[model samples]
Target chain A: MNLNNIYELRWKVLPPLAGVAMIGMAALALVTAPTEVIEGDVQRLLYVHLPSALASYFAFSVTAVCSILFLLKRDFKWDSAAQGAAVVGLIFTLLTLITGSLWGKPIWGVYWQWDPRITTTLILFLIFSAYLIARKSSSLDSDKSARFCSIYAIIGFLDIPLIHMSVRWWRTLHPQPIIAKLNPALPDEMLLVTLFSVLAVILVAAWFITLGVETELLSQRLLKLRAIAKINISEKS
Target chain B: MSEIGFLFAGFAVFWAGMFTYLVILQVKIRNLQSQIDLLENIIENHDEV
Candidate 1:
């Protein structure tokens, strides 16, 4: 197919497909899950909450990567991707904070704590928020702001691994891995649903990133055309 | 059952927020696209004149 068709696939079809997959995965999580002795009704919701945060973290990482590329290539595309990723990532991060707090309130007896996971996640959120705010303060030139954010993104992503691996290295009530470990915490049925949710969330995150990036590029183009049109009018006058 | 209601509430609120944001973006695209079209028309009319 032609390039436009490919663009359509990335921008149009992908997000819906991801959304369908996410819903399907959520359904599977609900259907297959046996009630946890510990968290009761809220336990099953882990499928959505954990995956949303993971996807958000993943999106932010993508932003960082694109930001680094922006610094190197000085290309607006990278900046666009980074910007879009930051916005979507922030949404997911906020979800993480909300859902994590909700889960924590019942499970941990506290809405929030200075735990490693929470602390690192908060750092990640601040990093992206700072990047976005930095964008606003910069000259409206997309590329320059991108270069600035890219540097921040690269620095910001360093905390992601720390956020992820902190629980393993230290003793935390946040619990250990159901996967990514020598021993899995979850039973196969629960694990199965979690896996499905991860996949679904990942695809959805990818689709979101693609759309956000494309939209940024389109906005830049539109802005340029407007500026040029204004210039032409001024010359005519 | 109360907990279940809250869970559902969370989902509803989250998804609604996401949908609203996307709708706003969609509106922006429409506005930009129309401007681009207008610009193109003006350029074309200028050529014909």
Candidate 2:
């Protein structure tokens, strides 16, 4: 097939492939991944929670990179990409918070805590949310809105590192990094499942961001057409 | 609630959140598609005149 056919085939295959991977990872995590010796079944939440955190990090990183590109190149395409990534990052960050809470209640005997890790993560969520709000409030001018959001995305990314380091840098109820460390404390089966879960989450995050970007691009196109139509009507009058 | 109850809740919340987001994406895409079509039609008619 030609290049266009190849591109079409890739897009057609990706969503289903990512969906299947997500299901398989979920099954492995919930059903087959080995239980923790200490935390028992409650530890199973790691399969979802940790991967969600990882996916959020990946999403935010994409936002940061795209935001930088938008700043340098001044292209709406990069702005759309940055906006999409920020949205995905926000959703996954919220998911991480919810799942972490659910996991915490049974283990820590509390649904919420003011631990450094938890606090920083909440801040991260709030930051990206503000980026979305800025995007909305500046809807009157697309270029100015994109530039503002790009700057917001870049500045907000500073929180990610602090969130990642909170447990290590301060006294906190949250546990230190396990899978992220050079020497992880996971067993073979658990480690395998964790890796699989991370992969699946990344794939799903990519799909979400791609969908967001496509929708944004289409909306932008429609907006341009409306503007043109308005100008035409004004000229005729 | 039992430990198992918490576990089930976690799974339920995760799955439900993902499903809801997926549905939202579809709805937004559909709305945008329709809007694009309408705008395109309006522009085409204006050009024809």
True contacts kept of 2: 0.73
How would you encode candidate 2's per-residue C-alpha lDDT over B1-44 as one tens digit per residue?
88778788888888888888889988998998998888788778
The residue-by-residue lDDT of candidate 1 on A137-236, one tens digit each, is 7754656566767787887787668666775366455564332221238878888888888888788778777767767777778777778777777766
- Residue range B1-49, candidate 1, lDDT tens digits: 3567546655665566567757776786688778788887776665565
Put down candidate 2 lDDT per residue, A120-199, tens digits, no spaces. Answer: 77888988989888886777247877888888888889756766676446644546433222224788888999999998
Model 2's DockQ score: 0.78
Deviating ranges (above 4 Å) for candidate 2:
A1-10, A162-184
Question: Best candidate per DockQ, number?
Answer: 2
Pairs that collide in candidate 2 are: none
TM-score of each: 0.84, 0.88
